[model samples]
Target: MSELVVAEGVALELRPARLGSRAAALVLDLILMAVLYEICYQLLRALAGSGASDDTVSALDIVSILLVAVGYPLVCETISSGRSVGKLAAGLRVVRLDGGPERFRHAMVRAMALLFADIGLPITLITGLPVLILLGLPGAVAVACSRQGRRLGDLLAGTIVVRERSETSPGTMPMPPHPELARWATTARVEDVPPGLILAARQLLSRVFELDRTAAAELTEELARQVAEHVSPQPPRGVAPYQYLVAVTAERYRREIGVNDPSNGTYRAYRGPRPGFPGTRTGARSAS
Candidate 1:
């Protein structure tokens, strides 16, 4: 698992794609490329037979090869945020070393390295013949040698392939420290909170235990303070900041799913607060 520190010092654990999965995705992509190339070749032939100029036919042929063989990965990755058809099928994604989305330049460099050095498609196009030589071996070797399973293109582009899907479902609901806090949360107005802040708080809470105790406490306090600014009936006194944050998050989740309006009978998995908090107190007493 690779640990990536995102905004607000929240660290996320991402698993790198395995070699076998990467190879399978690559093979699938190569097969699709072959099919596309064949279609383009046929179209070009049809144009040539229709009395098209030799210069036009030859230029079109080069363009076809470059577009179908060399441009496939570049366009797909750039548009889909580092997911090609094969990668999407295989549940793999290309992300930067810091777990950010890959940019167009990263995709371009990777595609050039892949076609010229790894698969040798550009060389085959230039020679006007298929190269039976080591196609895909160089990239495979680079991935095998690298500890993080980085191929040549990935190394050049500052990207790494990671598994996007998890084996188990995640529980995203946050629970307040005390049951009575739920009552306060249900009545408290929370319509003014920014969506980004809520998302950040959720991420921070999910990985709270993995962080250092002191750092986690500080971050939670800071985030909770920010959340309080947008909430009404300011969090009750004698309660830790995280408890208030949890109550707000849980209330938001409940409202989002219409749990308050209807009896859906849907079960939710709520994560309780982390250890080390003091014992729970009585009713939601307002802060002075």
Candidate 2:
């Protein structure tokens, strides 16, 4: 349940694949690869035909064998957008650390590094301390301890294996209220803002307080535009873009949490900023 913040400021909680699931996927892939290698070996032997010249064995047959051993997962994962038969079965997928789809290069790096660590099949047979040591040593050890849950290959490839989840599952900041924005926050229907925009809003809200004053204004404006695309009715005239964003966020929070707005006691829970703390209200300066 750890979240990753991408460059665009979208926060997503990517469920890293467990070591057990990763091992299972590796085993399943190995079995398939071994079966494939056996079939290829048989075919090559037949073509080399017991007495065939060394030239054919050295050239075409060796190349074909190598291709089968390395090509299967590489091609499958790259073409399938980071999914293999084994990964599909294990409910896992390889994705960039930035939370984008894995590209061919990402797949290739992981595949090649895995070829070294796994030696194609060794990761399954070579269990116990060695495998963990292999992955948990160096850059991987500390990173693994972090939220990412990356292995050596994942580190080298700048990728990680994660179980996909709906974007809204890992919630963001609770509904912080604003007196000026509360009216709109209570009535807005943001349940349909789509996961991507919701993530953007959450990220903006969470990070806005940390940004430089002018930069924060620009950032919030851009984020507000993104959120407004999916939200309806728009903010009333003179509402600052940031206020619009907070209202939408609170509305989404209410929908997901089933909380009643204390005033009227319904699901529309938009109230003032914290009791004594002086925030919001006067900060909104945006015009229509």
Candidate 3:
């Protein structure tokens, strides 16, 4: 079978998550807030009954609100590794714009920003409608214009909320007898493989069950050639064509196969028959 090679330098796909996911998160947050509000109300009432004054009561209310604001993000980040309860339930997370995990400071800044957007801005608009009418428009506009869907706080903190992609399953592709041959069977990381190649490989692999050996072999060979050309300057090195093909195939396999299993070691051997090869030379070789 001809091996499939992915193109170089493909842009990644990034899109806003579905409205349903966002809505679900919002609903969950509201429910949690309601519960907390009731608890705060009861606690404040008890404190007043025990001898607190009106001023104390008002101060406690502000403290309660602040606690809610802080708790939401802190709890989420600690429990779900940077995802709010709502985000966790919806399969979303707050990440840096660079696609890295977000820090607590960033999460806190985002949460505080959201609090201001939801509460402070509304209050300001109510108290000084004329001023808000003239100047508040820009604040809202700034948020909409920013990339990464960041608002003022998000922009300042360098954070963005994004939907998480599901992990690839193990043995998603058929196992090749040789590690070199199997390499072609494996897919590349989303960042490494071009979008077009990833899409093409997926489409081809999906219909692999229907393809005859001759057809599959032809497609694999053509794909291998393309990969060789794209990955040139670092193409597989060996004396024989089969060995070269196996070397290339192994690289692809590492990208595609997500499972960690004992069979992987055996399969790696069959892919290439070259001596002194990094993976196959040292370990147990599979029967060709």
Candidate 4:
């Protein structure tokens, strides 16, 4: 399973396509291309037979071959957002290494290299030296050696083809920004929280806001326990777990922003000595 960490720090699990499925998909696409090529080939011949000039026929043939052989795959993948008929049928899709959808340029680059492997290699083999072996052989070897089955084209394009996987809905908002926590947040330091746990906290906070009252309270408590494992200096006895997470996560956001430019004034920097957080005797900032 391939896991990608998105902007929200949520790790999304994706399934990478294996060799067998890739090969089958390629075969299906090739068959479709062959049918297109044959239709074009026969039409060009029929035109020549119908008293069209030999030069006209020859030119049209070259154009047809180029369009059917090279142009089809390029157009299909780009227009379909990294899916050809074969890829769609095979439940595969192409995406950037960063897990974003591939764009037109990426599709074009991948297709240009694929042209050498799909057409040039076979044509070259018909000759003695197999000149296009440079393209096809290297790409095949790269695919075999790559952990994610990337080929030369995919590497050059900074893309990967993965089996179609379920998508996750991004969180609506993160716990409503906990404005009350901002004062103490300036002094609070979050320790021992894993990134995944942090994401979970964010997700739960967002979801709980939309849940029924009983469900929200129940989920909040359960999620807080999961979050608490990674946090240090637990909240005081009377404080609700959900509220504790709000303060902790809010502090984390402040610190992350403050490191870049403390003068940015994104956080409310209370005057005087730093107040100890919940359960500590240090003078706490008064709520405005």
Candidate 5:
């Protein structure tokens, strides 16, 4: 079976996030909620007075609680840029399904859904059978099952929650090299190049490489065509396909090489030793 892979700095085997992270996020949220509830309850009681009618007092209580439920997520998301206070504290953020930044609408939907999932069912249980509480269970389960730990609300809103990692921890691995010929080239031995050069090249390749060979070739070909069309005069003679590939790859490592020519096509130049040369160590040459 074709495996479902989640790439990190390196291609690691996919695994579900630990439930502890979710629990921590929920616990933090509950603490904030308790504080909000206490403040709101006190304010409502003071406004209504002890002599207020039972109906009036009950209405005030419900309104105060509902307001807390509805507004908490919205306020948190808005202020923290798509992360609730709890999620922020827990080092997590909600992102669009496409791996882009989260938008306000998604935040709203997710916040509202969270309130319903966390509060609505309990309220229904107080007034109805125990089984009624199960209505919200699915929402929680959906979150647990999602790749990004997204709840039903997140799915509905086209969002996902991702944990934050330090800069040292590779955030997202660049797309893998194309599975066919491109993969062969990318998987080439690192020993052939300087350590810094190899690392830089890998970083560039990560961003542009794809796991599918056909797609990689198509992308490279299109890029080559564009370069051929755009440049006023063609590249100097003796720039074979391999040389061009080196040039393109080197260009992607812009910081190291300090050259930017989109017309050079997707490939960048290599600052490392020329290809086909023997290295100091046998293993190094073997790797190349």
Candidate 6:
């Protein structure tokens, strides 16, 4: 499982498609491409007739090859958001490094690479049947050697193939933000929070109940102290650090999804003592 931390520190766990599954998907795509090519070939032959010249025959072959090899993948992946027929059937999807949908440039690079490297279309055209043995060798080798099971195109395009489904679910839900802190959360500046700290906070919250009581308290205090340095307008007096973290995280989620402050049109700047600043309470008290 690869952990991709997107904006505002939301962690998305994606499983990289394995070699066997990828190969199976490729085979399925090739079978479909072959069928499509055969159809185009027969249609072209009918149009050209038995007395067709060499130039006409060559043009027909080029059109068929390009349509099946390059056009198929490019059109499919671009329209389907990184899923060709084969990938969709195999429950796989291509995504950018940040867990976002694959764009046109990414799909185009992969399609061209598939045509040139995986299918070896140009080489096959030149060498006749002998080059068939080497077809797909580059993609297979690259996938096998890549830690993320990515082919050459994936490396160039900054994309990775991941399973469409995830096997693991969040084990526990963190505490909800304190009701008193709701107003503060609506306008908190959480964009500056480091991804590492957010990930740590999420992990801590998930496992907090499982840890030794003394250890959990100590960790909560230490992590809250670090987090406070980045967040402003420390929670009102007596609000626990855990509650503070939950509130900040909620605010971050709200911001990430482009939800603006519903109550008021503008975000008023915070004037209260920011957490961890001089003259402010530690704000790390354990929640009851």
Q: How do the residues 1-288 of candidate 4 rate in per-residue lDDT, one tens digit apiece? A: 666543333344556676777777777887898799889888877766877787887788777767786777788887776788988898887776655566788987888777665334655656656563543455666777877888767878887778763222222223322454444444444644533445445555544445556555555556566656555555545556566666666556545444422234354443433322222232221111
Candidate 4, run of 10 with poorest lDDT: 279-288
Candidate 6 — which residues are off by over 4 angstroms?
A: 3-12, 46-50, 122-129, 167-288
Q: Give the per-residue lDDT digits (tens) of candidate 2, residues 150-227.
A: 766787888877764444554654455565466666666677564445655676666666666666676667767666
Can you give the lDDT of residue 262 in candidate 3?
29
| Error of model 6, residue 248, in angstroms | 16
Per-residue lDDT tens digits of candidate 5, residues 145-264?
Answer: 765565767767876555543211332323222223232333333222222222223332443333354443333333333333322233344333222333434333332344433332
| CA lDDT of every candidate | 0.71, 0.64, 0.49, 0.60, 0.48, 0.69
Best by lDDT: 1
Clash number for each model: 0, 1, 20, 0, 11, 0
Q: Candidate 3 lDDT, tens digit per residue, 1-288?
A: 111222221123343333456557757876787688779867877877868888988888878877876677666765554577787788766655433356677877766766666334555656775533433243345545644444565576775555554311122333342544334334422234322233334434444335555454455344444434444343223322223334433344445564443235644333322233222232232211
Q: Please give the distance, in angstroms, between residue 94's alpha carbon in candidate 3 and its true position after superposition.
A: 0.8
> What lDDT, from 0 to 1, does candidate 4 have?
0.60
Query: Which residue segments of model 1 deviate by more than 4 Å?
Result: 5-11, 48-60, 120-130, 167-204, 207-271, 274-288
Q: What TM-score does candidate 1 get on C-alpha atoms?
A: 0.60
- Weakest lDDT window of 10 consecutive positions for candidate 5: 279-288
Sorting all predicted structures by lDDT, with the top scorer first, yields 1, 6, 2, 4, 3, 5
**lDDT at 82, model 1:** 86
The predicted structure with the larger lDDT, 2 or 4, is 2
Q: Please, what is the TM-score per model?
A: 0.60, 0.52, 0.50, 0.50, 0.53, 0.57
